[model samples]
Target: MRYLVHYVEDVTERVHAEAERARLVAALAAERGQLRAALLQAMTPMALLVGPEHRLELVNDAYKRVSGGRDVTGLTYREAFPELEGQPFFDIQDRVYATGEPWAATAVPVRYDRLGAGLEDAYFDLRYEPVRDAEGRVFALLSYGVDVTEQTRAHLAAERERQRLAAVLEHLPVGVTFAEAPAGRHSVSNPAAVAIWGVVPASPEVAAYSRDFVGFRPGPGAPGSPEEAARRIASHEWPLARALAQGEVVQDELVEIERPDGARRLVSLSAAPVRDADGRVDGALVTSVDVTERERLLAESEAARARVTAVLESIGDAFYAVDAEFRFTYVNRRAEALWQRCREDLIGRHYWSEFPAAVGSESYRMHHQVMSERRPVHYETISPLTDLWIDVSIYPEAGGGLACYFRDITARKTAEAAREAAVARAEGARAEAEQANRGKSEFLAVMSHELRTPLNAIGGYAELIELGIHGPVTEAQRTALARIQQSQRHLLGLIAGVLDYSRVEAGAVTYRLADVPVGEAVAEAEALVAPQLRAKGLGYAWSGAPPELHMRADREKLQQILLNLLGNAVKFTRPRDGVPGRIEVACTVDEERVHLHVRDTGVGIAPEQLERIFEPFVQADQRLTRAQEGVGLGLAISRDLARGMGGDLTAASVPGVGSTFSLTLPRA
Candidate 1:
């Protein structure tokens, strides 16, 4: 040992060289320690995978924390993250190890069963670097990752939202458009916008929007031509442009647009400024809806309303409309005239306030009832204000209102009142005339009764003188007595006829009605008139009535009527040119009546005097010198008797030919 250091030549240099080497080695180890410490404490998740199996060799605190603090050291990547077996991460790492090329991935999704918990998904930005031997062959992989789960999930969610909005905009029914601020240099439109515009135009600047969009403003003083429309819709005037320039929100601005195909459309455009986070207008959002049909329908409805108003104004009847609160909404000209107030004054005025007197009248009651029941009512009432009768009709409106139609009937009411008064006066005059006629009939009845006794006494005295009961009489005296008796009988007959007429006129006569054979009554009349007919040399014939053909009349009255008719026929008829005058009786039966016709070949009555012959004391021979029989009272009495017993007597006559008297009686 003593001999080893004896020949040490410049050993100090050798010792110094060894010391420097050690120092260098210690510094390198320290630096490596600091690097390892920094890597472990760093917020970034970092791990080292070694060998082809990609076994986890070293893991920092951040990496362990990211792995849920699982002990993944010395474990293969596949074993550490079993859920990642089928994931691209495992294969990506293998490729990075085999290729020895540095690899990086952003938002690489991984599944890890952290701390024996269920596998949870995490997003990461991953980096894989190959660790090579000195021979330059890939041996191990170094994997470092940042747990970018929250950032990556947020980015993915935003991307999904953008895609969803894109899809929605594509299919939206309402047209939507977006334009960038600062003159709208950039613009985009949805499919609906393209459809609404009829063609998708190139994106245009804000200044060119008016020229490119081809729209017109509507209403009064609107553009009359295409050039005018273009000029009117200036760039700054457009809804979208206004929103972008002035930060204005324009809603439901109706614009008429002419499409490229020459078809026009009405669009309801709404625009709002799209503000940035700083509350500065950066863009414009526009929505458009096609309202052409709606606008057209509204215009048609307005026209119809105008037409209805015109008709209401032109109608004669007063017309007015009232709301549910009884406030007047509209009034026509007639209504204004009837109310004696201007339409401007009546409109929007309460009905009861305008006509205070009618507040509790029938008109008010009916109006309330109609409104409540939604029914129509018609009534007539006197106007409280004008004191005129009015016909009112109230109809319920569909929208909780009422329509009223009224008319002034004052003129008609006045005329009706006047007519009723005239009718009353006429009725009084008729009553007075009937009373005078009854008085005259009473006077005639009393006078005729008073004359009948004197006439009968004169006739009895004349008969006694002719019989020579007081003294002897000559032939001349007997003839004179016979003449006096004849005159007395004729006078008595006239007085009896007058008395009968008076009784009939005074309604004092009575009748006993019974079914009498018409033929039997006619035969009895013929017997009574036979003697007179023989004296006049007139032929008479009777038509036998059927036994079953009976007349419902008083027997005595019927016989009297027949006798009078036959006697008149015999008296009026005279032989003309040696031809004997003839009288004929004919009987006929109808459904409910029997007619007895007495015909005579006598001078017929004048057409004008046909009716006058039936009057009392009137005859065909009206001259005082005429040779016809006594007064015409026979026919009048006969007609009165016939009518008293449910029968009528009528006559038809032809001048210079013949006369026929028909007696019509109810058949039994």
Candidate 2:
């Protein structure tokens, strides 16, 4: 029974050992399958079981693709890729196999003949490793590689581009500077940048480089002094340092710096962040420009503008300037006053808009004419706004503009219009006076002719009865007849005077223009007036008469004028206060005229009545009961007849003293 039990235990132990062996075998097969499959289908190129003789024992699909479909399995390395026989790749692999050491190659080059394509070059990251048995004795070499052709070419291209950019930054005309981020290293600069910064174009760590930058000083009114400015640059407190440290972008920051020659230069600077591939700020690129000349020119232009403004403001006339479009550019104080607005309201405003009613007015037309013709124009126009007349002068300026100077002339224009109205009225009154004189002369002519003939017949009958061809009259009858005759003669004389006055006033009197001796004319006038003078018992005198004095006049008109004036003097005397009135006749001759004067010493004309005495139908004593016997036509007719003979009659008188009537005629 013990033996049966032992047999069963042994059988159980054998079955268990067999089961464990089978499980071990299955695991080994699975591991080998996984290894083979991983090699054959790997994206990376792989070769297995390569001998020390440099022969390829196994190759994967990736290796086949890298070899351009060339069958390289079971072939020696030299046979598979003959073009690579003299290269360092095989030597590197042989060294790995002989020493049983693994080797790595980065970006190694290899060339091989393709299956259907031509020979081509490729690059790879390769690994050569020795495969050893269980006793650690190397039997075969394993080679694996990554196809890094695109990456290798990309690295080479990036290196070339970096070199080219460095050269460009070094030679660019504008100042260029580079600063490394977080390091505060302003290590790169071109020649222009060094000149702008007044610093050495070297590494930032060098003391001289930082010291050279210390010479930079802030411009006037800046935030810092020279020492502070240098500290800002060195301590990364400036815009360039801020851009690199904080990844900030700064543009067109104006600053002034002291140059090497002890002169200040104005600079405009711009800075931007330079980033790495990981989007981290790596450095900053800064550019600068010198703007000193530009600033100086701007300041000069401002000064010149102020000078011109001062001149314009000081002018007297109302002055304004406008562009070609009639938009006001400048307006002075006087111009603002004339426009009744402020200068700020007028400047940059259209002319027509400021004065809307002047759009088609004469002033506007003249301005446009001057603009078109490129000349100057002067004109006067009435402003509808103020109702004032304006005298304006417009001049064309240099730059398609206009300058206008103007003033108000309303007062002068008003005075001229008033004078013209007064002259017109005077002309109208003179015409009316002429018409009235014509009517008076016509009435006088009819009365003189109608009454003179009847009065003359009565005088002739009275004379015949006084002669008495019918015989015998008593003294009383004779006396009555004489009185009747006297009345008849007086009526006849009055009629004749009316007839003479009518002819003279009507301008119908015939004139014989002959040279009449002045003394002879006075003698004839005295004889005609002597009867009246003696009857009134008036004293008479004559002096100042030159025998050689002659007058160009009508002889009869001259005698008639003198007779009327002397008779008026005799009739007015009336022996006042028992003093006989005196009459004087005199003549004065000048180069151009002859004057005949008749002076009366009794009942002189009043000062106010002298001018009225020469007017028709005017009398010295204007009452009906006055002592004067005749109508007041005598003096008027005398003056008219004197004027018709190219002469004038003027009278001067003082009341209660004397009167003088002078007849002036043009000398022959």
Candidate 3:
């Protein structure tokens, strides 16, 4: 231990030297790593180092940025950029490393494929350069890329805009033109403008066309541009010329241009001053709308209006029209004549002001109603202004107004009033006559009643005498008493018939109506008249009666009517010219009514005397040669009673033939 310690010099210096050498090695390694990191990070292109197995060995900040900051270290090129797999980008990178050459592409497109990366298509200029070691063999690849999406998009958009503008100018409908200001020198014209002017601007100047080709402003006595310009200078002052000269906008100006083929066209023109970059008017832009069709339509409308005015002025009836405000718009000559004023005076004046008295009249109200309801109204009113009756027809118009057509009817009204008065007087006289007849009927009825009492008493006394109730009678006396009884019975029948007829005419008879069997009533009526028929030696036939036929009537009235018809047959059907008398009674039914027909083969009534036979006191044989005993009151009474029972009696007879009396009653 003594010999080891004797020559020990301080070894701290050697230890320091070793430690410094180790520290210098560490610092150099760290500096080299920092420089490699800085160099990779400074490149803007997506850069990464790949090993021989194609796995990512190193990644720079630019690589992370291109991958949207995803962790792609140690991933193969196919795994790192999955969207570029099977694409030229991977092949290019491979070729650069294999061939030690550089490849560049313009506008190379790529897409990022990662979760939450919002991968969209990106275009870029890409360059791939092989990175080689000192042996000049490629070990890895370097990629440089620049985004060019905005520049590419801007170029495409500008091309599309140019195409749209060309299409719009080619297909425009209206005539469009641009010309130099104040000089009328043409710059350009659409196809429509060329066609409208009938000539393209051959000299590039509107003034090259003759004055006949240019549109001119309308002047007095010219509906539009005439065959010749109003003046050469006047044509130069048209819409386009004025806009360029004055630097002002000219809109909706009407001008007429004559084509080279001698056709006139009306056009509405609009123009505006075109400014240069310095805001000074250098030219004019003009447009034209063809108005030839519109001009023709306006001309036709004017002609139609004139015709309508002529018709109104020549009409016979009064015609007038008013607006919604009750102001008069038109009045015809007839209306003016009726008003005793000129048409010009009535037109444009308020209706009430013209005819103040008509303000609240029926005509005024009707006019208002027509306008409000949008329909026609017709009425008759008397004008207080003229005290004349007017017949008015009011019609609604599309413009919220009413048109009135009327005529004076005072003459007709006066005639109608006079006729009405005459009719009223006649009605009064008829009523008085009816009352007088009713009085006469009542008197006759009373007289008939009084006479019947005495006549019946006389008949009773004569019958008693014939029966020898007072004393025994001789043969001649007995004959005389029989004659007296016959006379008394005949007088009693006359009195009864008169009373019945009077009652019928006076409307004093009453009936109890019911659905009565027609057959039964007919049988009873036939039985009542059977005795008289037998006494007159007449053949009576009743057949063809429906068993269930019913009529809505009074049973007694029906029977009475039948009896009267049968009695007449009995009286009139006595043997005439050795022909035996015959009578027929029939009952028939239809859907609406029941019919009872009584036909007699007798001395039929003459055609002239048949109508009078039913009148009271009238007889078919009124001459002395006639042998009928009773008056015609029976037939008249029977007819009236039939009517009261909802039935009518009609008679048809032919001389030397037969008479048919039909009773028609409503069927139940």
lDDT of each: 0.83, 0.80, 0.78
* Order of models, best lDDT first: 1, 2, 3
Q: How many residue pairs clash in each candidate?
A: 0, 0, 0
lDDT by residue (tens digit), candidate 2, 450-510: 8877877877877787788557777898899899988887777777778788787676788
lDDT of candidate 3? 0.78
Model 2: pairs clashing at backbone N, Cα or C within 3 Å: none
Model 2, poorest ten-residue lDDT window? 208-217
Candidate 3 residue lDDT tens string, 1-668: 45554566898999999999899889978975985677577766556456444566666766666676677777887787787765677677667777778898887777765233677776778887776765877777665577676786677679889888667766787788777765656567778777776656654334655333334555333444555444535546566666877787888777777766567777777888999899888988888777777788888999999999899889889998899888899989898788888978878899888788878877768877887889897888887777889888999888887888999999999999999999999999999999999999999899999998888888888888878899998899988888888888888888888888888887779999999887788779877877887787888888866667778998877877887788878877878788778998887778898888899887778889988877878888889777777777887888788888887889999988889999999998
TM-score of each: 0.48, 0.42, 0.55
Superposed Cα deviation of residue 236, candidate 3 (Å): 24
Candidate 1 TM-score over all chains jointly: 0.48
